[model samples]
Target: MKTKIVLLPLDERPCNYLFPQKLFLHDDIDIVLPEKLGDKKIPAGLKEIDSFLTKECKDATGLVISLDTLLYGGLVPSRIHNETEDKLKERLHILKDIRKANPKLIIYAFNIIMRCPSYSSSDEEPDYYEEYGREIHEIGAAMHKSHLGMENTLPLDEIIEKVPEKYLNDYISRRKVNKALNLASLELVKENIVDALVVPQDDSCKYGYAAIDQRDIRKAIIKNCLEDKVLMYPGADEVELTLISRMINTLKGRKPKIYLKYATEAAKSIIPLYEGNMLSGTLKYHVLSAGCQLTEAYEMADIIMAVTAPAGNMEEAINQPSKYPEYYAERNIAEMFDFIKDRLSEGKIVTIADNAYANGGDLQIVRFLNANNLLMEVDGYAGWNTSANTVGTAIAEAVDAYHFGTTERHQNFLGLRYIEDLGFCSMIRQKVVERLPEYGMNYFDVRDKEGKISELVKAELEEFIKNELSSISNNLKILKLIMPWRRMFEVDIDVKYIK
Candidate 1:
C-alpha cells in the first residue's frame, strides 16, 4: 500500500528531537514535507531532515500532517499577522490539490505543544529567531498558563495580569489569532480534508519538560478521541509509538510462540539500562526476522548475568556523540560505549530499539564498532543509537539466553569490552576545539589570550589536524565503504585536549 504522510512540524527543533529520522525509517515510514519549511541550520554533513522530508518521499498509504508548523509561533516564518483567514484558505487549497493527485491517501494531523521559547546564556531563542521569539514566548507562556490552577494547566486571566496595560489588549488580540489558526487546522477533520487528527501532548506541552509522557497522555487521548470515528491520539513528534503500531499492523504470516518468549526475555535485561537515563523509551520490533537488529541483540548474548547484578562502568566510559550545536557535551559517546561494553561483558546484547541516531557523525561510531567486530554481533540499527532503554534491552536478551544456556553457543558471544582506541573523532569537532582559545581575540586582547600558551603548546595545537587528527578523516572514509551502516557509532576522540 502507498501511504503519503504530509508532515509540518513545529519548526525543526521539536520535530528532529521528537520524530527522529532513524525511528521513522526503521519502520519504512515515508516522511513528506512541503517546501515552505526550510532547514533549521544544522552544520556540515549532518542529515538535514527538512531536505529528506520535503524531497525524498515516495508514494505511501497515508499522509500525516502536523498543524503546529502552520500555526506555531516558534516556526521561523509563521507570520500570524500576514496569515489571515483567506491566506489559510489558500494554503489548504494548495494541499487539497496535492492530495487529489494521490488517489489512495489517508491523512493524520498533529498539533504543536504551545511552547515558550527555550533560552540560553548568550541570548535570544538560541540562534534561530530574532526579537519575535521573545514576543511569541511571552504570549505563549501567558496563553498556556491561563484558566487552570496547576503548573501545567491553563488559566485564561493570567494573560491579562502579566502583560502591561498598553500591550495587554494587543496580546489578547494576537492570542485570539493564534487560537483561531489552531482551530482552523482542527476544523480540517470536519471539512473532510483529513481522515484523522492526532492532537498530541508531550511533557513540554503539559509538564514544561521536554518529554512525552506516553502512558498517561497517550492512553487518555486514545480513549477520548481515537476511540471512535477517525483515529486521534497523543504522541509527541517522537513517533516511536505510532511507528511501532504501524509495524505491528503490517505483520503477516504467524510464527512460533518461542519468538515471544525470546522477546520477553530480551525486554527483561534491556529495560533497566534506560530506567531514567533518557526522557523516554519503548520496545518495538519486527517479528519473524531474527535477522532484525532488535532480535539479533538477544540471539547473540553469551554470558547473561542475574538480575540487579553489577556490570562494569563501561556504560559511563563510551560516548554516543552528535554534530549538532545543541549537543555540545564531549562525554556523550564515551558514556554510551561504556554502557554497551559493560552489558556485553555481563553477557547482555544491546538493541537500541527506540531513539535513532541521525547525524553523519553518529554513523562514524558504527564504523568504530565494526572495526572491533562488535557491530554484527552486538546488534543495533545505524539510525538508532544506544539510549538507556536500548542498553537495558541488550541486558534482558543476554539474561534470557543465560537462563536457557545451551553452553555451545557461548564462545560465539564475542567479548565487546571497550578497548583504548579504535580511531574515530568528528573533524568538525576538531576545528571547533582548535578555535576555542581564539574566541575573544582582538589586536589589543591578543596578548591576554596568547600569553598563557607556551611555544610548545602553540605548535602542537597548530599541527593538531595536519599531523594528529588527519588520520580520523582518512579512517572514516575507508570505514564508510566497508561498514556503511556503522556511521552512527563513531564519536570524535578529541578528549585528549577537551578534558
Candidate 2:
C-alpha cells in the first residue's frame, strides 16, 4: 500500500515544512507538501494551499496540518494580522468542508498558542512589539504566576498598576482572539473533524501567556473528555514533526525503539535558553510524543541517540572557547563514541543530537567525527537552532533509518547536516558576523539600511562550506548556499545528491 501524507505547513520555512517531508520519503510512504503559499512571505498563500487540498489531497492516507496557515495565511500573519473575529470564524469553518471531503483521512491538526517574545522585533510578530514586547510578556507572566498561587507575583500587579491601559487592553484583546481560535480547533477535534489536535505554546516561559494558554487548553481538553485526542504542551516548530512521526508509525504498525544518551549529567538539569523546561524533560516528551519509546538497554534499540549538550548554560559559541568552557570539557564523549562506533559496526543506526551549543554544533565534536573518519560511521547528525530542533529532526531521521536507511542516503543526509549545522551556523556564520563590521554594518542588523538584504555572503560562504564539505562528502554536490532569513541566524542550503 502506498501511504500518502499531505502537509500544510505554517510557513515555507524549511524547518516547518521541508524537514518532515524529507523524513517521510521512504519506500512505501510518500510525504507530499502542498506548494508553499508564496515566496516565503505571508498573508497571501491560503488560496494556493486550499487549491492544492481541493485538487490533490483526495487519496492522501493522512494529513498533518497547521491551522495557522489555513485561517491566517501563515504563522507570521496569525500574529500580525488585523483580521476581525467574524472573518477568522468564517475561515475556521473550512475545516468542516475539508472533513466532509476526506472523512477517512487520519487528520492530526495543530495550532500554536501564540507566543510573546522577550524582545519585540517585528521580524515575525506585530509592529508594536519593539516598544511594548517585553512589558507585555512581563505582564502576562505576572498574571500567570498569580494563577499558579505563587507568592512573588508582584510583577503582574506592578504592570497592571503602572502600564498604560490602552497597551494592556490591546495585548489582552489579541490573546483573547487567539485563545478563542484555539478552542474552536479543539471543538473540531471533539466533533471528529480531526482525529487529533495539538496546542503547543511557542517560545514559552514559566509565567507568561504560554503558561496561561496551556492551562486553558488543558481545562478544555479534560472538560470535553478529549485527553486521548487533544494535547497541549510547550513547543512550536517541532509539533508538526512530532505529529507526522506519530501518524507514520501508527500507519506502519511500528513503534520505534530509541536509546537516548546525554552529553553530560549536568546538561539535563540546565534548561537551554528560549525553552520552558529542562533538556531531559523536553526530550522525554518528544520521544513519547512521536509514538516512540525510550529504552535503557542500548543493544535492543533500533536507533541510538547521543545528545550533545552544554555542561552549563547553553549559548551561541563565539571563537573564544575559554568563555564557553563547556565546549572544551571532555564529557567522556570518547567512550560514548567508541560504544557508538561498535554499534554502527554491528549494523545498528547511531544518530547524534548535537545540542552542545544552541544554534550550532560543537566544533570539537565535528572535528572529532572528521578526524576519526567516523563521519560515515554515524547514521545521522542534527544540530540546528535548538535542542528540540536537533532531537526532533534526528528522531525523524532515525525512524527513516529503521525503515529506509541506506548507506548512500545516510551519508548524504549527514553531508547536508554537517555542511549546514557545522559549516554555516558555527563556522561561517561567525566569520560573516566578524566580516560584516568591516562593511560598516552590525552583525545582528546586517540588512541594508533600507531593510533590504543582499546575497553577497554566498561567495564568501561557498569557499569555506565547500572546503569543509569536500572533506566529508566526495559524491555530494553543494548546489547553493543562501540565507533564508537574510541573517546569519539560519541558512537554506541546497544539496542535489540526497534523493
Candidate 3:
C-alpha cells in the first residue's frame, strides 16, 4: 500500500505547489491538495480548504499544512488581514477538530514569521507599504536595538516622523495578531494536537520586526518545553518540502546520512543576502528538518552535498561583475567538481547547492558542469532563491533520491533547475527585462503571462541552452512556460527529456 499525505501549500506559486509534487512523482507516495488554492494576492477559499481537510484526513497517513493558508487564506493575506483575534482563533480551532476526528493522523504544520522587506514595494504587501516600507523597516530595527539598550545608527526619530501615525499603528496591530497565532500554533504542539511544527522566518535579517518576533516565539517554545517538537529557521517556501521529506523518512524508518562539501572553508560562515544566520546555522536546521543527519565520515555517508556558497559578499546573479573580484579567489570550483566526481564514482548520491549568488545559480559553476558533461550526473541541484530556499530544496531532492533512487522525473527536475535557475535567472531574465520596455511592459506587469514577453523569454532560453549547454540541450526541450503571477520575478516552466 502507498502512503497518502494531503498538503496545504504556502501559496499557489510553483515553488510551494509544483516542486513537491514533482519531487515525489515516481515514489510510492501520493500528495493530495485542494482544488482551489487562490491566486497571488487573492485569498484561497477557506470553506473549500476546511472541507478538503475534513474529507481527506479520514484515511490519510499524514497531513502537512501551512497554517498561514488555513488562518488567513494564504501567505499574502496573512500580512494584510484585518480579521479580529477571535475570528482568527475560531479558524485555528479547526485543526483541533481535525485531530479529534482522526486520532491516528500524523500532522506536520508550519507558520511563517512575516518579513519586512527593506525596500518600499507593495508588490506583496499592503498598499501603504509602497510609501512607508523602508521607514517601517528602519523604525523596527531602531526600536529593537533601543529595547536591548544598544546603539541605534538609524535616525530613529526622523524615520518615525516620516511615517504617519496611522500606518505605523496598522502595521504593528497586524503583527500582534499574527504573533498571537504563532503562539497558538505552539500550543497545539504542547497539547499533542500537532505532532511537529516549524516556524520559518521569511526573508529575515539579524535585527528587525521578524527577528524580534522570533525571539518571543523562542521564549514560548522554551516556556512550553517543546524544543524537540518545534523548530524555527530562516526560510519560507521550502519548509513544506522539507517536512514532506521528514514524513516519508519517518514512515519508512529511514534517516539518511549526509556529508557536506563546501566550495571554500569560508562558505560555511558567510551570511547570504535576505537571511539572518550564517550558512552553517541555516544548513543545520534544514538538514535535521529533512530527517537527515550530517556525518563527518565520508565512507558512512548516504549522500554528499556540495555547497557552492560565496567566499565574500553575495550579490544577485544579474548584477555580478564580469571581472571576478579578489574576494572570490578562494573558491576552488575545480576542487568542488572533482570531489563530486569522486563521490559519484564511489556510488554516492551527490547533490549541488549552488548558492554562490542570491536569486540565481552561479554561472561559472553551471558552465563548468555542462562543459564536463556532468550536468545530468548529479542526483539533485537547486539555487533558485534565498540560501535557505536553495539548501532546503537540495536536501529534499537528495533525500528523495537516496531513498527511492533517481528516476526520469528526478532527471527532468535537475534539468528544470538548470534551465530556470542558471539560464533564466542569471542571464535571460535581465536581457528580457531590458527589452520589456520595447513592448510597453515592465517587470511587475508583463501585460500577458504568455504574450510577447514570454515568447521572447522562450527564445532567449532556447538560444542560451543551445550555445552554453549543447551537451544536454539536444535531449532537453521546454514543453511549457508561463509567468505564474504575470511578472518577471518567477516563472512556471515545464521541461521534458526527449528520446
Top-TM-score candidate index? 3
**If the candidates were sorted by their lDDT against the true structure, best first, what order would they fall in?**
3, 2, 1
Every model's TM-score: 0.43, 0.89, 0.98
Off by over 4 Å in 2: 39-41, 151-157, 160-164, 319-330, 407-410, 437-456, 459-470, 497-499
State the C-alpha lDDT per candidate: 0.34, 0.74, 0.89
Give the Cα RMSD of candidate 2.
3.2
After best superposition, candidate 2 residue 478: deviation in angstroms?
Answer: 1.6
Candidate 1 TM-score versus the reference: 0.43
lDDT of each residue in 144-229, candidate 3, tens digit only: 88889898886689779999999999999999999999998998998899999999999999888988999999999999899888
Angstrom error at residue 333, model 2: 1.8
- Flag clash pairs in model 2: 141-207
Writing each residue's lDDT as its tens digit, candidate 1 over 250-326 gives 33222212111121122333322212121212222211111122223434433322111111111211244434322
**Lowest lDDT 10-mer window, candidate 1?**
477-486
Better candidate number, 1 or 3, judged by lDDT: 3
Model 1 lDDT at residue 246: 32
* Model 3 regions lying over 4 Å from their true place: 321-327
Winning candidate number (lDDT): 3
